[model samples]
Target: MAGRFTGKRALVTGGGRGIGRAIVERLAAEDAAVVVADVDLAHARSAAEALRDKGFTVEARTLDVGDPASFASFDERLDVLVANAGIQTFAPASELTVADWDRVLDVNARGTLLTLQLAARCLREGGAAVTVASIQALLPNALSANYAASKAAVLSLTKSFAAELAPRGIRVNAVAPGRIDTALSDFGSEQVGRITGQDAAEALQRRLSTNPLGRIGRPDEVAAAVAFLASDDASYITGECVNVCGGDVMA
Candidate 1:
């Protein structure tokens, strides 16, 4: 289990916090030299410094996944890529503006495309890519039209990339997370408050009741799945999305 990625180089977008940070830590734990790429340089630096303190080979960089210029400067060769940078906005369909829709798609869908394209250029043969999608992609939720649509597009891209990259000895996969207790999930509580007229805590409680596990998932849980897909252990898997949704998405 240790040193599964000894001497490997990995890049994780949005690695400053939450699920992305968790993925970075997991990869570093396995001995990969990890790049904590995020839009916020400070967060990325903080995460990298903390990991470095723990004796992990980690670095930080500012990367805007939606911008080609940012990706162009990413010159380091890579063995693993985790396309985890994304944003979520919640609003009723009628209340959603064009800007809201565009922003969500730009970051979640277009960003995934750009990240995968860069990985194609940098990843060595037999490398792997894992995308962070959402359970909402498969099980749509109220007031999350834009977020859900963008994630669904990511799922599609995962399959497409997997097929095209197979010839290059690269494997592409996705992890669809359930309700995870992160800042992103905290936003869900606000969304629930807006829709149901309840406080944030109550909204979260009501939401948690719907899951079969009767609780939200952890960021590290999703990271574990991504690490597996990125490792040689999942060599036979590609063009598939593994659900980490606590039985919320059975399909």
Candidate 2:
């Protein structure tokens, strides 16, 4: 059977690892030519090469999601754009340095905007964009205030873009994931442990227990959601944040 994304061209940011990598792989599996764009050039190239070795059409590029110039330099027409690049910081709102907050916002919120803007400029009519938000955007976590705030902004941005882009036959959506076990989460846990004197495992356990699924989500699971949103199967879906959070939150 032909996959939903067959014949498409997808650009995925942060494609070096975790959910981003999973999305890149899935898109290729569905027969879409993919660009694995990431800040880690080595990881990006390795991912692209591995997919190529597996007979999937894929390429790799270096992109700093926070930098507009980095994104613009690619200048390739795309059918789908997945703004999955992001970072996290752990500290009480009062304890976090301004630099830490800025870093998170730059990578998460600003990066998302740049991805959407660039995609709008280069994608053909009927193209789609997917922004990766987080469950923390809806469920408050004091230690992750910066991350949560940025993700909240992503949801709003998705809606805003959808309203403006709908006239052009473009759809914009977002995915808000819960406790997914990825390198980003691992790094987040480590920072949490250092800041709160708790073991990383303990912190993760506490966080994961909040999910109704009783287990953290996998990157592939989140990728499936993103792919769905980017496909014609979701043609009518726009300006929505599909929560892949294992029922951790509802509204």
Candidate with maximal TM-score: 1
| Count of clashes, each model | 0, 0
| Full-model lDDT, candidate 1 | 0.93
The whole-model lDDT of each prediction reads 0.93, 0.90
For model 1, the stretches where C-alpha displacement exceeds 4 angstroms are none
Model 1: lowest-lDDT 10 consecutive positions: 135-144
User: For residues 1-251, what per-residue lDDT tens digits would candidate 2 score against the true structure?
Assistant: 24777788999999988999999988998999999999999999999999999999999999999987886587778899999999888889878789999999999999989888887897779999999999889877888899999999889889999998999999999999988889888888898898889999987888777768889899999999998999999999999999998898875
Top candidate when judged by lDDT against the true structure: 1
For candidate 2, list the clashing residue pairs, or say none: none
- lDDT (Cα, 0-100) at 78 in candidate 1: 93
lDDT of 2: 0.90
